[model samples]
Target: MGFDEKAQNKAQEFQGKAKEFVGDKTGDENLQADGAADQAESGAKKAAENVKDAAKNLKDGLTGN
Candidate 1:
């Protein structure tokens, strides 16, 4: 299957971890910052997906789906 929002966000989080690890090993401040930003963005995306899913569930419940 194509990447869903959850999968995309999870992949992004793993990528951030890899970057952070590389930055730490290489002593690259910019890379570290970028990795942190990526992680934050991933977290935000996950939160948004959660909200959307919750909304959909609520709507479905109300509509007897």
Candidate 2:
């Protein structure tokens, strides 16, 4: 994935971790769930980007790039 996309995903993942930590310390179930969802979304985005990169690499290889 591109640098911008990777950085954004990392930021999101970090934010989620922070949220989870705060929620756990404060005993906020909803916030904890939200944090988990955010982390999952970030993970999904990263996975999709990885797949796209892999496909691009495969195409470039076949084309002798």
Candidate 3:
């Protein structure tokens, strides 16, 4: 987990919202699906980052760094 990954995940989440809105407005099922997928991925990414950060913290603690 790092700043860049966090920012990218945030950006992805926003973009997915835009896509979902546009899809709803235009009645595009594919776009809506894509947006949903994007949102899911973004959520997963953030979760992964959190896990990584926690692991890093544990490592640093053991190593005294």
Candidate 1 local lDDT, 1-65, one digit each (tens): 23685688888899998898899899998888888889999988877877988999999999999
Give lDDT per model, in order: 0.86, 0.92, 0.91
Q: Write the residue-wise lDDT of candidate 3 on 1-65 in tens digits.
A: 56887798899999999999899999999999999899999999888878988999999999999
Candidate 2 local Cα displacement, residue 64, angstroms:
0.5
**What's model 3's lDDT at 22?**
95
lDDT for predicted candidate 3 compared with the true structure:
0.91
Q: What C-alpha lDDT, on a 0 to 100 scale, does residue 41 get in candidate 3?
A: 97
Reference-based TM-score of each model: 0.80, 0.90, 0.79
RMSD of each: 2.2, 1.1, 1.7
**Winning model by lDDT:** 2
* lDDT tens readout by residue for model 2, 1-64: 6799789999999999889889999999998988888899999998998899899999999999
If the candidates were sorted by their TM-score against the true structure, best first, what order would they fall in? 2, 1, 3
Q: Candidate 1 or 2, higher lDDT?
A: 2
Cα error, candidate 3, residue 4 (Å): 3.2
TM-score of 1: 0.80
